[model samples]
Target: MAKTNSTAVAAALTNNQIKRTVDRLAALKAQIANLETEADNLVDLLKYQGKGVYFGNAHKFMVTTVTGKRLDSALAQSFLTPAQLLKCMKTTSTTSGRLYAL
Candidate 1:
């Protein structure tokens, strides 16, 4: 009878341990799911919203004129003429520097 009680106790302990492990695993899974959802939300916020100039809106934006100081004299001197710069713009879809898509 003593051996039987010991065996029963061990079996109960094992079952409780297994149940606790399963519960812990389930909670971890739920936490991962929530994290994934938050990650997706953050990605949506960070990525280009495709709204600025790509979408045709009723609002008319002011066309800002480039000041003479804005032009790099050294860089401008590299090109033969403004026509060369215009040609480069026509040929290249994307510029080497930071791109502002219009």
Candidate 2:
């Protein structure tokens, strides 16, 4: 099928117009993802260069290195039986939502 070229910004858009707009939105999102990925690599390079504050023409950025000890859940589970692990485990509920396009 062909494509629609209705770049209308009214609330009363036709079905095809909405579809075309969604297509444009998805394209823009893809472009943003590509840009963010590229910039993230540069940011990683800055982090590797060392943790310090940096300044641009009008902006300042900081690279910080955090040191902390994290628990190894898999290793701990190996050292503990199922009953012991269950006794030590804690449960929590969180509110979550997601949007899907199909």
Candidate 3:
């Protein structure tokens, strides 16, 4: 039937689009991972010998010290009562979608 053929074509097109999107996402993930590694290396080199700042021809880098308290969730869970644990917890929801290659 014409309707069946049209539906098939639409499904094929949707699959192709999903594949392309997934491929693009994979490429972007690779690029981001590479950039993160490079950034981490740069940070380590710059932070060596207690250096705080570096001036370059195209970029400026500065090291900042931040102090904060973070909860040790595992330790807290072991020691705290259920009610106490609940008091320390905050719940959040995130919505996201991903396409994968088959």
Candidate 4:
């Protein structure tokens, strides 16, 4: 019958739409879980480091060098604290400026 055929087509379309929605939701849930896991790991690492001590991951020579330059500019506000400058020196290219306590 014509009515039966139309009803079957409508049911198929509804099923297809529901399937796509569920798939998208599952993908979003997976991405959220991954982000949460990364946040938890970072929080745990920070907790392990406690207060005052800095927490940093090891980097290659070039990455370290770039990071040093960025830090020098970035930390200029904190009176360029000795510890920060020393951290900069370990990875720096600059040799003219001597670090002094403020």
Among the numbered candidates, top TM-score falls to 3
Instruction: Please give, for residues 1-102, the per-residue lDDT of candidate 4 as tens digits.
Output: 367546465564567786775676677777998999997887676656544445358631121212333445665747878786777565547656232222
**CA error at residue 14 for candidate 4, angstroms:** 2.3
Which 10-residue window in model 3 sums to the lowest lDDT?
A: 4-13
lDDT for each residue of candidate 3 in 7-71, tens digit (9 for 90 to 100)? 46556456778777578888998899899999899888888847477789998888778889987
Q: Candidate 3: where is the Cα deviation over 4 Å?
A: 1-13, 74-80, 97-102
Cα lDDT tens digits for candidate 1, 24-88: 76777779989999978855554445333322376432323355756675687586587776665
Candidate numbers sorted by TM-score from highest down: 3, 2, 4, 1
> Which stretch of 10 consecutive residues in model 2 shows the poorest summed lDDT?
1-10
Tell me the TM-score of each prediction against the true structure. 0.34, 0.55, 0.63, 0.36
The per-model lDDT (C-alpha) reads 0.59, 0.82, 0.80, 0.60
After aligning candidate 3 to the native by TM-score, how far in Å is the CA of 48 from where it should be? Answer: 1.4
Candidate 2's displacement at residue 64, Å, is 2.5
TM-score of 4: 0.36
RMSD of 2: 8.8
